[model samples]
Target: MSTTVEKIKNIEDEMAKTQKNKATSFHLGQLKAKLAKLKRELLAGPTGSGGGSGGAGFDVARTGVASVGFIGFPSVGKSTLLNKLTGTHSEAADYEFTTLTTVPGVIMYKGAKIQMLDLPGIIEGAKDGKGRGKQVIAVARTCNLIFIVLDVNKPLAHKRIIEKELEGFGIRINKAPPNIVFKKKEKGGVNITNTVPLTHLDNDEIRAVMGEYRITSADIAFRCDATVDDLIDILEAPSRRYIPVVYVLNKIDSISIEELDILSRIPNAVPISSENNWNLDELLEVMWQKLNLVRVYTKPKGRLPDYEQPVVLRSSGCTVEDFCNQIHKSLVEDFKVAVVYGQSVKHQPQQVGLSHVLMDEDVITILKR
Candidate 1:
């Protein structure tokens, strides 16, 4: 176990010392592929004694429509945020290592129940199997959103370190999957195509990465300008998760208005004071948007729409049929058509088929044959 980690560290050290250029592109690509494989193995736990987190993962039986994981160093007020947002009790203190395991909470926002988990504190070398970092980040990989809680007094380096930790674990925060497409072929040799000129990737780099992965035959198409890292991410897509993240700058009451204004300038950042309960509403609003959850009201025939508990659905697969499936699996079998009376419809009450995609807050009334 220690030897694998040592190999990873050595490869990373070599990668850092080597400069990137036309001459070193192939070597760098190989090193990156090697590093990725070693890290994957470390997490896989070949010992079969439960790798990464040791026993079982800290993951709970997930509830609610979406889950948000809170990750930060100890005493960054993550537990406080979890308590305030979810009204679930999580032991909070000014000291480090206060929150040991995953403490779950539930946030009722905009008719959607979002689960929030206060994960164990993360250290600088957590990604490299330092501390309980693997366990903490393993749970984070399953979250729909992540709250990277930061102390207002902490240096910007803390934020960078946490980001690197997540990056190493194949968590791409606040990013979409790369536009590059990869396809496997049996007979044809590797064929590459790019619609746009790639500035950060060369032929050698691409070939080197694929070769290291033992991908001898594949069709590669790049829709946008891509880099070697982007190609690597594409290849590591199975292990990767593209999740939305919000930088939660806590203890904002200790900072002045001038400092608050400057902190707010950071992209996708929300400043809040969990103790003082300052700016929590704004934080919730931002969380709702980032979650991208759709709140759909189910209106029974000849009755008002039930606005209390919406049939919440994710934005990616929120069609009339999907909505019906959420209510009951048999609803689809008994389906005829749907009457949508919201942003998804043209008239006050327009009849839509099961394939019609629903927008947020859309009122849906399914009719059975």
Candidate 2:
């Protein structure tokens, strides 16, 4: 796969060199994005391993490497948020439609990696092929989560306009609802009560609003399971082609305490100040929890070996002896016994036959002597 990708890149580079006049900056950018996406797919595993199939599918085995899609209306601080999250320093401007294309970056969170993609802003009538909304939605379908950024200053009706557009595209993302982030000046500290109106409501009203959105206190507990299966059920339906979603409330530094309080009432709505760089770590932690990833380590005991080295094997109740056979016919022929080291003391360093059932992350030392 690496060779194929390299060859494709070489071909593109050669074409760019030969057809200088034909290749535009936009074309080059598209090529670069394709190359990057391909590299990511290869690292994640075979394509369509997650849920969906074809170009719209995601890689499930690579759920530990989460990807969040930043989506919202024009000038909703999507680009700024991406820059803040990944430190990519992408171009950010105050004008509408500053980002004409989708940009991707990697953000490291607590030793885990998450990919953040800044998608093109959506406009009204996007579902019917208006503006760049359709293209943006296509890009978003490839992500594991979507952070719908909304300006709190806008009226409720205007906010609904964005939601309508998303719904028009037949994208059913209920897990991570659109986060209402109030973007304003950076002078005053984030005042939840003053800046966010939702904070002014009593706990009962807050719960009511969450209930209307299908978000309840139980959802928080449900999210704690920290497994891909849980995340999948939360974001996408039981269908074979659904991805997870996460809500992010960005630009909290601009809001008043009262308004911020109201915003805080929403479940799983993260507050972040892109300008001041506040709560980014907390946001990442929330995303990690939402991903529900399980870590498995493999120590080679020697050199790390190449990238293609297989540390884990997919099996069907095969024993250690069978695994040795799979690794090489000669290893099975010379297989004497297997030493296991894990679980209780009785099982520690125990020499067992090839029929031993391997538990998750069990350390097995095969003996040929």
Candidate 3:
């Protein structure tokens, strides 16, 4: 029996050879679905390897309100940057693969504790279980932000390779979930409704992808011009994570001014020299923006809001209830109402209930019943 990787390659080869048209749409869709499933299996750990997410030694205790993982090819200054940023040492060296395991550190920025992880170097085929790449990327998946460290002297194409490896492992960097809604029913046949014109995919291809997942009865709605792969991604929603990523182009000191200018133009990329500590502050600023954390200041009953120590929450779950729960387990149940003052509220110091959404720099004082 061929291995998962081999099977995937065969499907890919077939896909490359098969032309996309009305006649081959179904075949191509099936190939894409099969390719995606096989890739998932490969990332789940090649057949009989016990299918673990990562190595025992690589899993470190996550700290702070947010975490950032450093991933790159060998000797890309990940350790040096981590040491400089967080004042923690991780045994940096000139040779490749100097860092063998995950090194954890912390940085307190603007009163928010952010965890930094220095991971080992990963080579090509890392997604295929080559040289701890999967383990390194597995750590990255849990990070609130990812720093794709690259040596300024190396080929720029390395960025694309690293991104491909991450994507193969189901990490969608700086991407939102597709605007496709799906529901399954007992007996209704697969019905696809499109609010917009279906430009990237047609009904035949959609049906083919749905068929691969063995979905006979479902209601599918598309609000965007999504491709067949996007539909497959929605089907594989449990395995997908849409996370933010910031590309850290390391070793800028080795390059000239012109090169630095060109590097700076890349979207979502920040260039810095970990060795000289150049542009690190800018990198941190970009990281802060990408994390999108909301800080809520607690105001005592009759006093002012606490500015020294504010509760940091992710923007995705920032709400009055989430704020109370972050404070104490019973704060929500003991809550009668909350007085809020900030951009999240319209009036000054308005009384809001548990479900009220909170925003950054919002001041809140709770009254218990």
Candidate 4:
């Protein structure tokens, strides 16, 4: 075990010499800590027959991988949407309780692999441990984003029941609320009508109106380009959290062109037909843009550097120095300067300072010495 630890450290050192990336250093530290923990466990030895309850210790799951979970009432096309997004057929049906277990699938979007989990549908009394709602809630806690699917055809009462169940589950939903996807619409068309106060309508009424349009209450639009400040006004007037909510007016194949145009006009409303495979790509692109992601490519030297692969960073209008700091703390500390190359200019190395803002496709080499 000690030899193995030494070997790991040597490998990390070699990597540090070759590539100056912050993520690599952080990962190396994690590896060292894990190795230390294993050594300690081994040294402790034979606690109730050399392994304890299960007879063998298992590794805890590592976090930090971004994941999204599908959550909503039963029979809201959660499974169908998951299949469409991830191409992992997780059994879709028209009836309630079709999804008995949590299904996980991965979809590649904007050059990143995103894990999407389809959790069991939430029902009434879920928070109080009725209808196995607690189990569903447990599955949701791991997700970075929740896709709250709502049945437009279902009664508003049922929709309220589901929302209450979610509140009862006590999941720390983001300030940016989960995206809403409406399902199961008839052939005619759904109307926007008006963006009413959530407090004015009971759950049943909300469900009725949304069902007519095949959307969730969250999908209703407010003018255009509604910023966070504008959302705060909407939420305060009605007294709700100001979270960014996107509406997907799904089942477009069944709707009319005029209705589709109406949906397009609605702020952040995307019309998609997952069954006929329409507008899914556009929907994904829109989601990515809303998430505010910027792509940075790591040069493909002889061998693809595992730790230094292309990274997607949260865009904040920062310069190349900011990017370097995000990549690794050591690189920032030892930062002498950087040389720019590739894409925008010829491979002629241009010396740059820490304040140099990077453009897309600007290949950079750091001179750590």
Q: Work out the TM-score per prediction.
A: 0.95, 0.50, 0.96, 0.51
User: lDDT score, residue 365, model 2?
Assistant: 56
**Between candidates 1 and 3, which one is better according to TM-score?**
3
Off by over 4 Å in 2: 1-64, 155-159, 175-241, 301-369
Cα RMSD (Å) between model 3 and the true structure? Answer: 1.6
Number of backbone-clashing residue pairs for each candidate, in the order shown: 0, 23, 0, 7
Candidate 3, residues 1-369, lDDT tens digits: the string is: 999888988998999999899999988998899898888888776453423456877989878999999999988889999999999989999998789999999999988999999999999998887888888888888888999998878747899899899888888989999999999999879888999998889888988898888989999999999999899999988778888988898988888999889888989989988899888899999998899999999999989789999999977557789998888979988899999999988899899999898888889999999
226-320, model 2: which lDDT tens digit per residue?
A: 22222222333322224455556666767798998897776667777777788878877777666554222223434332233223333224466
RMSD of 2: 21.0
lDDT rank, highest first? 3, 1, 2, 4
**True-structure lDDT of candidate 2:** 0.55
For candidate 2, the TM-score is 0.50
Candidate 3 off by > 4 Å: 46-52
Residue by residue across 90-199, what tens digits does model 1's lDDT show?
99998999998898888788888888989999999887788989889988988999999999888378899999999988899898999999998996889999999998
> Per-candidate RMSD vs. true structure?
1.9, 21.0, 1.6, 22.4
Q: Which candidate, 1 or 4, has the higher TM-score?
A: 1
- Candidate 3's TM-score reads 0.96
Q: How much lDDT does candidate 3 score?
A: 0.88
